[model samples]
Each structure stands twice: as C-alpha cells, then as structure tokens.
Target: LRLVNMRFECVGAIDLLEFNICNNVEILNCDFAPADNDVVSAISTVNSSWLTIRNCRFSSPATDNGFDYCLYAAGGSNKNLHCALIENNIFDGMDGDGTAIHIEALCTASQTVIRNNLIMIRGAGIGIDDDSDQAMVIENKIFHNGGTPLDVNASLSLMNMLSDDGTVTWSPTIAGLSA
Candidate 1:
C-alpha cells in the first residue's frame, strides 16, 4: 500500500490510519492533524514489515489525558516487524504522557531506522521510544520535551542528534552505543 501527498485534518478516531499484517507499505509526504483531544494516534501498525514513513507531518492538540502516539508500530508474539524506516518527518504539539514515535515488539535483530526527523512536544512525554535493541536513531532534532528525547531499551546507536529542554541544548551520550 502506498499513500502519498495527502492531508488528514481534524480526524476523529482512535487511530487515523491503521495497518495490520501488511508488507511493503509506504506513506510519504502526508499531513495529519487530530480532531480535538480525542485522538490516540495518527498512524498505527501491527505485524507489518518493510514499512516506510517519510516526509510526513503530525500535529496534536493539548489534552489532559494525552494521546498515545503520533506513530506507533507493534508486533505480536508470532508476528514481528522485519524492517521499518521512518525518516524526515515532523511531529509537533504533542503533550502529556504521549510519545511522538513508538516501536515495540520487533523481531530479534530486526533493523529499524529513525533518522532526520524533527520532534517537539510538550509536558512529560517522549520523543522516540524503541523497545527493540536494533534501532538506529540518528540526526534527529528534538526540542522542548519534558521527558527523555530518545529512549531505547537496550544497545542501540544514536549519533549526530540534538535535543533541548527549553533551557539547555545538549547531546546525550548513551552507554553501549555502538560505533
């Protein structure tokens, strides 16, 4: 499946886009704006492989409860994501306990690449959270988030990244990051 050059505005749903058991999917140059504060995610994927999301923009409203994510990818017990590439996207206006991008339950040693993105959120949320150890996060600009900019569970590599928390701009050095 391929979705290109589209605009999704004021979409009132749990997930504006959902993909399950899909392969070779591409979403490019799209814009997403959730309706009010009732939306959960802009895009969600389950058991998908070889997915690419690039050059997209996502915006959310400020909510008390806070939504889940701008983009989420999850694999089941039997099904696991093989490879996913998310790059050159912009995620903004997220608040509370939400995440801009969340990747979880990937296959062992499956490589997921997150690079060249701009993520800015409010409140105590995360910019990127990867449960898999095989993620490569590089060249992302994260600003004004109250929580961790990049959170990886195990050994992953992060390079050429910039993060700011309104007062300080610094590069985080992670232990066990491979060269």
Candidate 2:
C-alpha cells in the first residue's frame, strides 16, 4: 500500500492511518493535523514490516487529556516488524504528555531507522520513546519538549540534537553515544 501527497485533518477519535499485519507500506508527503482531542495517533502500525514514512507533518491541538502519539509502532513475538524507516518528518505544536514518536517490542533482527526529523512539543511530552536495540536513531533535532528528548533503549543513537530549554544535556550512556 502506498499513500502519497495526502492531507488528513480532524479525523476524530481514531488514528488517521493504521497498519496491522500489513507489509510493504509507504506513506510519503503527507500532512496530519487533527483538531479533535480524542484522536489517538497520526499513524499507527502493529506487526507490520518493510514500512516507510517520510516527508510528513504531524500536529495536534492542545488537550489536557493527551493523545497517545504522533506516530506509534509496536511489534510482538509472533508478528514482528522486519524493517521500518521513519525519516524527514516534522512534529510540532502538540501539548500535554503525549509522545512525538513511540516504538516498542521490535524484533531483535529487525532494523528501525529514525532520522533527520524535527520534533517540538509545547507541554510535558517526550520526543521519542524507542524500546529496541535494533533501532538506529540519528540526526534528529528535538527541542522545546518538556520531557526527555530521546528516551531510547537502542544501542545506536548518533548525532542527534536535543534541547528542552536553552540548555541541552544528555547522558552518553543512555543515548549510546559512547562505549
């Protein structure tokens, strides 16, 4: 499946795009901005493989009941993602405790690349939350978020820039930038 050059707005109470048990999916040059506070995620993938999401924009209105995420991907033991690429995207103007990007339970053999993205959230929100060593997080500029910039369990994070206030501080052991 391929979705290109599309605009999704105000899709209420659900994910704008969802992929479950699907493969070889591509989403490019898209815009996702939901005014509804009940909206879950701009994109959600579960047990998908070979997926690519690039050149996209995601934003949501401020809500006390924070939405889940701008992008969410999860894989389990039986059905794990073989590969995924999320790059060149922009996420901004979000509020509350929701995450910009959330990934979890990826297969050890699988490779997930998240790079070259811009993430800025208004309130106490995380920039990225990845819980897989198979993920490579690189070169993303994350700023103005009230929570952790890159909360990753991955072993391959490189060249990423993060700033909550005017100052930026990160533990090299946490980000895996050092031995």
Candidate 3:
C-alpha cells in the first residue's frame, strides 16, 4: 500500500495496478498507461512478497491482445514470491501477445531480482515461468522485441547469466539472441 510518485492512466482494458496480500510493496516513480486495446496488465501482483518496482514506466496494447503483461508476478498457493525487485524500470510500448515481464512462481521464486531494466517491447520478453527458483536476471536493456529476451522455463538449474555487456539487443534476429 505504498505507491510513491504515482501516475496511472487507464481508459480501456484497464488494470493499471492490482495487488493482493500485500507485503513490503513499494512501487516507486510510477507511470503506467493501459489505454484500451483490451488484454490488460499495467502492473499486477498476486500473492505478493517484497515486491518493489523501481522507477517504473510502462505502456501496453500495441497490436496483439491476450492481456499484454507489463509486469505480473503471480505465484501459487504457497505464495512463493520473495525478495522481488524489478529495478530501474522502463518497459516501453508492448502491443501484442504478452511478456514484457511475467514471473509465475509455484515451487520457487526465492530471490527474484530482475535488474537495470529498459525494455522496448513488441511482445514476449522476460518470462520466468515453470516453477521459478533463484531467478536473477541482471543488467537488462532489451530492444524492439518479438520474444526471447530471457525466457527461462525454469528448474534444472537454468540460471543463464547472459553477460557480454551488450545489454541485449535484437531487431530482426531471434534465433539464439545476441544482436
């Protein structure tokens, strides 16, 4: 219940912000726009923990629907979301499908930390489903997306720490990432 520097604009497919079982929830410097185009999720948290979205800005509904996720952290009955920190956020234009950021936990989500964000989206980027565990995606700056910025299916130690210092950019290329 601690929303700081708030600015939420919703006209149509609205869900500018949603919460549940609030813990240390802190959304700082917020600016979210869910202006129609159906399929909504500007920011959503179910079974919340130490959820902290920093320096935020998100705008969804560009093309597709299926509820474009600007930021959604939904855990299971165990409410596994812990130590969550989505840092320095700036997830721009996402308009189709989904996956600007979606963390689905069931068996894991112990130290969920997605760092230094700046994603210019088209849909599908950063999805940590399949029973998330010690997820820590670091130093992010994804561009012009069409899936696969970091889609870890989780389990079996899928701790892919991608660091070439390029900050993740892919325009037309998608095959293995790195452009």
Best by lDDT: 2
Candidate 3 has a TM-score of: 0.28
- In terms of lDDT, model 1 sits at 0.73
lDDT of 2 by residue, 1-179 (tens): 89999998764678877777658889899988876455788787777778888999886555553356888777576655557888999987455777888877554325878889998856778888876556788888888646777887545787777776776644233544442
Ranking by lDDT: 2, 1, 3
lDDT of 3 by residue, 35-147 (tens): 55554678777776787889888755455443467876676776656777888887764564456777775634677777777766454444333336466666566664345
Per-candidate TM-score against the hidden true structure:
0.83, 0.84, 0.28
Highest TM-score scorer: 2
- Across 76-111, the per-residue lDDT of candidate 1 in tens digits comes to 575555678889999884657778988774543277
Clashes of 3: 4
Provide the overall lDDT of each model, using Cα atoms, as 2-decimal numbers: 0.73, 0.74, 0.63
Q: Which stretches of candidate 3 lie over 4 Å from their true place?
A: 1-9, 12-15, 20-33, 36-41, 44-69, 72-80, 83-99, 102-108, 111-120, 123-133, 136-148, 151-179
- Backbone clashes, each candidate: 0, 0, 4
Cα RMSD to the true fold for all candidates: 3.8, 3.5, 13.0
